[model samples]
Target: MKKVFQLILIIFSILNSAQQSEIFKLKNYRISVLNDSIQETSGLNFFSEKLYTFNDSGNPAELYEIDKKTGKILKILKVKAENKDWEALTNDGENFYIGDFGNNAGIRQDLKIFKIPFKNNQLQNDSLKIISFYYPEQQDFTPKNISTDFDLESMIYLNGKLHIFTKEWASKSTTHYTLDPDNFEKQAAQKIETFKTGFMISDAYYFEKKLFVVGYTKKTEVFLMIFNESNSGIFFKNNPWKLYLGSALSIGQIEGIAVDETGIYISGEKFYSPIGNTKPYFYFIPKEKLKF
Candidate 1:
């Protein structure tokens, strides 16, 4: 019986290895190393056909417009909102939404999204609005540190609603939730769906009916998942094409992704570990280089 159990375990290990081997590797896409000003670029978004990014918490409340071919800051837009733990950015053509909801300890009760109107190449910071929300299912305010599953960093604006993806550290999954951008009062985020990504999601982007989500695992393995939008507008119902994007040690901590008709743009923040450190990087992958 012992030999039989050992044989079964060997078979399972082989099958798992084979499955992991099928994941495609992304390579030859490094464009340039990011500037030191935006070393903590946590989110990426395209507004009015221009690429923009911003740092996470502990940085100024500002957005940096960067050149696509070269990772250089072209302009900086100062915001009037508090940074807090701003982790995600999205736009609705007329306004940009900044998500200040990075709850790594899962004890935050003041999750907010800042809405600022952009008109005629100007940001109307005077008319900024704050939208507050909370997870209705979460009854506890305990501090779980990095083990909490309520941390969020990925968001996208779609069809008049803001879609948020949670960074589930303990479960290695992500939960999709939707919130009304027009609502100003504190409300509950409507739970939609959940997907087992096997990694914590950092940032997300939407383009041409496709959703691009990027993140790194605890083992420092970076990955990107491309999901096709369903006819009913629900994502994660279909299996995504998961691609291995290399190790964080070599590529830095990937935290931002932005896709367009031209190509896909990925940004990684400076990462440090006991072993070594990596500088922030920017990468561009042409649409033709991707399988789907």
Candidate 2:
């Protein structure tokens, strides 16, 4: 097909950060396990076309409209907010951003990001619209352990800008920030330049312009970055990240990724806890079998 898409983009330009495997024949995705061990699962979003999961903490703030390809939950939306460790999610068709900022002990001072609006696809209430902010530069543990703890799970809202991704505790590597949820608080985050990515970056999705980032350490990998449209507009800020590492073999904590031309959907949230109770796997990657 174009030489398997230029050899998976030349193995994502020699990008490898652990788990070890560079085969690339990709198109092997199937985790079809709907609702199991999902208590403190994490964030995932798509809103309405189905697939809307959330959790990491508390209350009746649930929503899972799944079935992008048979992970089947069908419908279950209702929120009030208490999803503390919510982590990351993205949407802009109207609402559904939800990312309470997972600050794994970097000492959070109140970092949040919740929108939740949507109407026809239902979900027009429950009082939600909090886009708090933090990280005014105060870091430590230069490379201590637990994977470079910057926290933020994953996010996306391109064009209007809202790209946040970082989960680098002991340094598995990932850092990209740029937010302005319409001036969340008079514009705060603006760094967007760090993806030496070798591993560790738990969730993120941005279809057409393609930017899928999943993660794992003992195995479970997925990375596809392609946001190069010359990055059009007002003194462009940071659309320079380019990395591709996917062909799946280490499928242990793939987290969650979503793209829809009827292809590309992954999830692996078995984070060790009383989650939906244990059994989450829904991988069906295909978009010309993605390369590298």
lDDT of each: 0.89, 0.62
Candidate 1 accuracy as TM-score: 0.92
Best by lDDT: 1
Per-residue lDDT for 1-292 in model 2, tens only? 7756755553454355322443442234665655663534465677646676665655356767776767767777776777667767788888777777777666666777877787887776674677777665655534333544577788888788788878875666777777778555634667756655556677877766556666654333455444443353121234434433443333334566777776667676553321112345667766666542
Residue-level lDDT tens digits of model 1 in 50-123: 99999999999999999999989999999998899999999999999999999999999999999999888678
User: Model 2, 26: alpha-carbon shift in Å?
Assistant: 9.8
Global lDDT of model 1: 0.89
In model 2, which regions exceed 4 Å deviation?
Answer: 1-5, 8-29, 32-51, 54-63, 67-69, 76-87, 90-97, 100-112, 115-126, 134-172, 175-213, 216-265, 268-281, 284-292
Q: Which candidate is the best by TM-score?
A: 1
Each model's TM-score, in the order given? 0.92, 0.33
